[model samples]
Target chain A: MAKQDRAIRTRRMILLAAAKVFEERGYQAATISEILAEAGVTKGALYFHFKSKDDLALGVLDEQDSHFVVPDRACKMQEIVDAVMLHAYRLQTNPMVRASVRLAMDQKAADLDRSGPFLRWSNVIQQLLEGAQARGELLSHITPARTADVFVGSFAGIQSMSQTISDYEDLMGRVSDLLRHLLPSVAQPSVIASLHMSGSRGAVVHEEVERLQEHDPSALAVG
Target chain B: MAKQDRAIRTRRMILLAAAKVFEERGYQAATISEILAEAGVTKGALYFHFKSKDDLALGVLDEQDSHFVVPDRACKMQEIVDAVMLHAYRLQTNPMVRASVRLAMDQKAADLDRSGPFLRWSNVIQQLLEGAQARGELLSHITPARTADVFVGSFAGIQSMSQTISDYEDLMGRVSDLLRHLLPSVAQPSVIASLHMSGSRGAVVHEEVERLQEHDPSALAVG
Candidate 1:
């Protein structure tokens, strides 16, 4: 059991290091040697966990998907807001998530299949939007899939802009502004009014997710 | 005058070659040797025109900003739509414009300053939105600068998403959908009813710009 725990920890350390390198140097420029140096792991250990740089990149991308969901909300609109806010918060605070986003948006990484994160995000948001539509929390003209694409694309652009502008220091504010402009067109007025579309909403949701995880580790499912 | 024309043509040819290489290989992977081969130009000619690869990229980035503007419209909102639609049309049809956009969005080009396009776009859109507000074509609560960021960011994302999904074959449709979703919440209902937000808006605007340019060479100033 102790040996298994050590292996898991080593794998995580390697992933985190890869994430940092990928985020800084981008996927095309990042090297396994740098990752190994950063993680202080042997080449054998790194190879044991990830066969190639591409595999290591995929592992970092998968980190964004593992076990961090926003806590549930009564209103589906609010749920969507929390989900977006939570991501923006994590993007501001977490290196792994930031690296994953960079890789997914990196057009220069011609060898890497960067479609996974965008498609996965669009699908996840589409389901939540469909649920919102069923509950009439959204505007009548809102098509779940189309609106989902807009949300995903806009968030990607907004974060990219923020990264270029302030290295994501102003990401939460920009995200808040985005939701403010978009939500009015997307959700019912009542729904929009009730939703917390503040820059600080992310920090609040992050706390909630953390508390939920502390109480029940299985609460990591998508909110 | 003949020699000047020849110089201008040669410079344009080199820039086009650089744009193509930059679009395909990105900034870091792209080489001056490749661009020279692509341009079929001598090393002396390339150096005479561009000091370095970075200078060549800056030249490509500047191409997107040069002299393509929508014609005038009485309605500022329509003008804003036309500006966006015109750019979308160009992105779909023009290789230089597409390459410039790719560079602007390429996160892997750490040495390249990608903020120019985003900031310029935001500033342009902000002025248009401000004009719309002054003309009472916009909603009462519209904050021009913030809303401008949303438009710029959303458009960037939508185009990037379209590129990833279909190589921008469906960019017009996606952009039209974005305007449809966001316009109702932004403009007055009457204004929204009067605006053109179709996929074909881009092609129509493209034709208009072409006709205007042909009629008066001096009509290159932004609308």
Candidate 2:
């Protein structure tokens, strides 16, 4: 059992290191040696766990999939939006997740089947949209698939832009505002009203807190 | 003057050859020697025209910007939407444009300042929205910038998906329908009425013709 635990720990460390290297240097430029050095694992141990660099990259994808568990909480549409926004905010705050996002966006890593994360997230959004539709919280004609695509795509575009700018405060606010305007096209009037009243406030506060941490990590830690 | 003409022809040939090579092998994997061989140009000539591979890639970007010119016709919202739909249809029909689209999406290529073409196309949409706003065809609260982003983003998403699935017919129809529904949210009631009645016809015809051409390219060649 102790030996098994050590193997798992070594594998996890390798995945983390691989993700960082791939994000920073891109998949094409990143080397297994660099990953091994960063993980502080012996070359023999690395070869023991993974057959090739492709296998290791795929392992990193699997590790990311395992780490990103969507929370199952009951909430109104407004709360769901808040949760998603907060999740985006948290991804911006966490360096590992930030690196993962960059790796996912890297064209070089396109062969890594990075679609797994997006597919999972889309499923979550679809479920939420279906729930809203069943409760008549969505517009009668609004197809859940289309709504989900728009939501997911816009989220991706906003995330990509935010990463490029690194100005979380301004971008997050615009994202929230963009979502607010978009909701009315597919969401029920009442849901839209409720969202307008409370959704923006939650998003603003969440984003502000993230911005604070981003601006001064030590200050946030001290606080 | 004769030497200048040879340089221009050589540059054009190299750009075309580079586009093909880049499409097949992707930007990073494609080699300068291969591009030179394909263009039937000497290494010295290639170097004279372009300093390096990156310079050649940027030249491809410039060529694309100059080649794919959107028509500057003033029309109603529905007409504008039809034009957009037709533009997407042409992209589906043209292999070179499809390759260019793929190249544009490439992560390594995304770092290049290939914004010239995109900016021009986006400006056209902005102008359409601005015209609607001026004629009181748009809602008081709807901003041209936001409308342009949504329009551009959705179209881009549609094109991206269509390219992946090779399903242009249904995808284009869905995009057309989505835009038809979307315009009502921002446009005057009369504009919405005009769009539903006439827009549906143009969209259906546009998609049908594109589908036919897609299935049988010789049909277009014969015509």
Q: Best candidate, TM-score-wise? A: 1
Which 10 successive residues of model 2 chain A have the least lDDT summed? A64-73
CAPRI band of model 2? acceptable
Question: Which ranges of candidate 2 are over 4 A from the true structure?
Answer: A1-9, A28-31, A47-52, A59-75, A102-114, A161-170, A196-223, B1-9, B24-31, B63-65, B68-74, B108-111, B114-118, B161-184, B196-223
Scored against the true structure, residue A95 in model 1 reaches a CA lDDT of 79
Instruction: List TM-score (chain A only) for every prediction.
Output: 0.93, 0.76
Model 1 per-residue lDDT tens digits across residues A1-223: 6999999999999999998888777777789999999999999999999999999988988887565476666788888888888898888888789888888777667788777777888888898888889988987877898889888888888999998878899888889888887888888898888878787888988887888788976655563
lDDT of each: 0.85, 0.61
Error of 1 at B139 (Å): 0.8
TM-scores across all candidates? 0.93, 0.74
Worst 10 residues of 1 chain A by lDDT: A65-74
User: What would the DockQ be for model 2?
Assistant: 0.25
* Residue pairs of candidate 2 with colliding backbone atoms: none
Docking class of 1: medium
Judged by lDDT against the true structure, how good is candidate 2?
A: 0.61
